[model samples]
Target: MSFAPYNDLRRHCAALGFGNQWTEAACALGNERFAACPHGDYPRWKAALDGLPAVPPAFRMREGMPCLGEDFQDQQGLADELMTFHPWRKGPLQLAGVTIDTEWRSDWKWSRIAPHIDLSAQRVLDIGCGNGYFGWRMLDAGAELVIGVDPTWVFVMQWLACRHFAGDLANFVLPQGIEDLPEQEVAFDSVFSMGVLYHRRDPAHHLARLHSLLKPGGTLVLETLVLPDDQADGVLVPEGRYARMRNVWAVPGCERLLRWVAEAGFSNAQIVDVNQTTVEEQRSTPWMTFESLDKTLDPQDSARTIEGHPAPRRAVLIARSA
Candidate 1:
């Protein structure tokens, strides 16, 4: 499905003189047909539209106009930058060294338990390892071998980073989902999955697939959004983004997730930690332009709230395989 906002962005760019060139470039990049923009006149072309009223000034135009720059280049740049300086970017994973305060690490309190897990010898698998930041951590933590799986073309960054840091790209595999992970028939001793379960339409199926990938006594680390006590079957935060079967399958409670893990043959499970406070403290960065912020924060927009609250909170879960 096309992200509506991005489609709107394409239209906005077209209105500002970035027409067929931008659209065709974006399509080609989206289809993975080209690496960097073949026509390299992106910055000059984008500069030509610098004063256009239709384009959002906040839009960073550089090297390969709306296409590679916006569509792929920026993301790749961010991934490359993140990989280069990751906390575990160098030596053995130091639990206390990770300082980036992204939403993923907000509730992360693994430092206290780091000493208990034998990361150095365990076979660790990181599912949905976007940019492989955490995967790098696993390696530093002493994991003998760290395998990261991500389906996006963004994996190119992970592949490059692995070649540089780990000395091999074989450790980082690309699989659309757990179901497609058979290429690595070697069962893992521990699996780390974060910020992924909630996005699945069939979370239970995903869990089952994960279970199948593990050897006996494997550990599965999970983190996801959960509904409040009063709300069962998940809550509808904003109109189009509800917790439904075809869409995201938000667990109503730890009990719901535990049930799925148990059905997948996991014998033990529990909420190792809950960060409702962290979620409450979170806030989106304000847009530089008032118009952009207004469109997102407008009171009339049903798509901006959770039962009327500004944003919904998420819950994290950690479970073990039977």
Candidate 2:
């Protein structure tokens, strides 16, 4: 809710020796998008941010958990204030003293990814980076800086919660989507598009956007819902909804996924890790009260969603920009 975040980000970009014009444009976009934020809950979220204790900013990523600050005015009150940003989708973060068990055990996904990509000293971009959780993980993996974007305002609020404890850290989250970013070819050293491809109406266009964001031969870390090879011919275009998620436009088979990336000007597209989503990995917790994977799948069959579609299976593919 404050311009301080953008200011810190701009200064960090400058310190990293990024192009002045691009950094300025990015800061402007961040300010503009935040100014016109349409989320009705913005006021309450801002108040929650304002309500946080005036603790010294300190951040450390310990064992995949972003630990922020060491002291709090009131632990219970701090927890209550954080609860205002409910339905926390990504975390298990350590905020001051309060531990937030988020909906997704996102660290598990990161474990599957960290082994495949080399992010040491890389300038990275993360699309749909909920509350910048992976940004910390990426930072720990040795990325010099991580610019994360997510459309959801609550996630931005959550990032602020972490930022409240992180003084001028290189990890930043802008309240914008990947499409909203300025088109800068050869911009980042690595680009991550996770849990996002299936939601795009045109996955090819999405891939192109990702390609344009990275430098030639820059690493591309893409994680998305993928169907088994035998399940669909090429891509599965769900008739109604997939796993009660209406936005899922297409779930491609592993082979078609490679083809899409190949046609999008990416080279050496390879499936690095593929794992079926489990209820234990994603379920409602005290911090996220809504129903999750447990209720999304069929009670009768573990391998099928309640909608009778194949159960959720995700894949992490590593590619290089051509």
Candidate 3:
């Protein structure tokens, strides 16, 4: 079956100077990837998405956070339906009278970086956009269009479920990655790569890819895990899992990350925020019942991961394309 959201994305991109040919090809690529998704929960997640209650255009943040709640007669049913897509890691999505308290308080990250970038009338791209939580916030910040890409099947389903209620929204999330886009396309005015850099085995290559996505002098907001100041000029390549995530490859200090951004060909690669992640920012919520930051850290010393590496400290950098 054809993905309705992809159709919407194609139409939206057509009007945004991406041209009909690029839209067609990009959406076709997304469709082929979706068709081949091997996730076991894809069927159930798609069913849940199809069953979401129809609502009007009620996309707004509640008390400075992204929310999609609307008055629904069957509130319990709504809760049950949304729970099928468990492990909601990146949001505190308030959906149809039921609040999904996700693992990460993603709004906190948005607050730290939002003031630095001007999303107003900008075409934005978010790589590793878990469930498109940040994309909604980007639209709220007045972005002309927000296109988020992640290869995870369940996250794509989660985004589709959220988009079903958003109603003709300009923000879209594709089941693709930064590598999937053509090199030096330079289509977006702002590009965000949050919590994704460390996962790449070659982070410099990833930064270069992000640089290629932005237009000349366009802004790039990057947030990723970093080591402490004492480890400046040092990069920790975890022997195994770091903070319970196996994909985490490298965690460099703030200075080293700034250097990496500079080497990637971005100018004004300066650090805007550096804060160690806390349990309050990431914890087990009803929406995410699995192991969280608390479990992954050394109980005796919060300063270290269970694997004894420096605990997760993230840094947000704002750079401009050269």
Question: Per-residue lDDT for 1-322 in model 3, tens only?
Answer: 6654577787788787765455576677787777777788888888888888986647878865566746678878998898898878988787766777889999898889988888889888899998999999989989988888898878888888787766778878888877786442446789899999999999999998888878889999999998899997889999989988999999998888989999999998889899999999999988899988999999999999999999999999999997
TM-score per prediction, in order, is: 0.55, 0.96, 0.96
Residue clash pairs of candidate 2 = none
Residues 1-322, candidate 1, lDDT per residue (tens digit)? 4212123324433453433552333333433321332344433422322322221112211121111111222433334343333222111211112123332332133442354466766667778776455555555566655556665533433333333333332234432355545433446778877667866767778888788767788888776666555553344333444322234545445566667778888876766655442322332322111122222232565333433433334555556677
Q: Assess the local accuracy of residue 267 in candidate 1 as a C-alpha lDDT between 0 and 100.
A: 75
C-alpha-based local distance difference test score of model 3: 0.84
C-alpha lDDT of all candidate models, in order = 0.46, 0.87, 0.84
Q: Is candidate 1 or 3 superior in lDDT?
A: 3
Superposed by TM-score, candidate 3 places the C-alpha of residue 56 at a distance from the truth, in angstroms, of 2.4
Error of 2 at 168 (Å): 1.1
- Candidate 2 yields a Cα-based lDDT of 0.87
Best by lDDT: 2
